[model samples]
Target: MKSLQDYTTVIRPDNNGIFAAYIPLLSGCHAWGQTPDEARAELIYVFEMIQEEYKEEGRSLPEDVELVIANAS
Candidate 1:
């Protein structure tokens, strides 16, 4: 698993004014923030939680999940 401090993060504004933050490495594990700083910080915590889940289940986590910035709708 990539460290939270080392992995690439993408930040985007969402419909509700909160920002969504995602890791370039993990799929389905993300965080939301009202500000950019919170978004980044939240991602770190989300990453750790995902890591713990993976470790406990003895399963591999999906990586390289790309974030789509545009809404298809």
Candidate 2:
């Protein structure tokens, strides 16, 4: 089973002093909060909701990917 921690979360503070978080792997999955921690917490909830929706729709959940860089010779 895939867990929330399996995905990569991007969190940043917006100009309005609110923290915004989004999962790059999950399209349109985002949340906002007053602080980074709060934003992350909300993002977790968002992830759960998205996962449930996928399950209901009989779709497979997206998997996380790892990026690798290689030096060009």
Candidate 3:
């Protein structure tokens, strides 16, 4: 079973000063807020909603999804 912990979260600040949070492996799964913490909280809520939606639709999140972290300078 794929859980929220199975996904990699990417949070970054945009030029507009809003923080963007998303699961890169999940299409259209995203949220935005004024701070990184807020963005993350919103993302958690969105993820739960998405899970419920998929459950109602008799579908499951992709099991092949993988998470990779990289550092850039």
Each candidate structure's TM-score, on Cα atoms with residue i matched to residue i, is: 0.68, 0.84, 0.80
Ranking by TM-score: 2, 3, 1
User: Once superposed on the true structure, which residue ranges of model 2 sit more than 4 Å away at CA?
Assistant: 67-73
RMSD of each: 3.6, 3.7, 2.7
Residue pairs in candidate 1 whose N, alpha carbon or C atoms collide under 3 angstroms: none
| Residue 57 C-alpha lDDT in model 2 | 95
What are the per-residue Cα lDDT tens digits for candidate 2 across 27-64?
97899999999999999898889999999999989778
The residue-by-residue lDDT of candidate 3 on 28-61, one tens digit each, is 8899999999999999899888888888999988
| Pick by TM-score: 1 or 3, better one | 3
Model 1 local distance difference test score: 0.80
Give the per-residue lDDT digits (tens) of candidate 1, residues 1-73: 6577555688899999999999766776699999999998888888889889898999866545444678789
lDDT of each: 0.80, 0.88, 0.86
Least accurate 10 contiguous residues by lDDT in model 3: 61-70
Error of 3 at 52 (Å): 0.7
Worst 10 residues of 1 by lDDT: 60-69
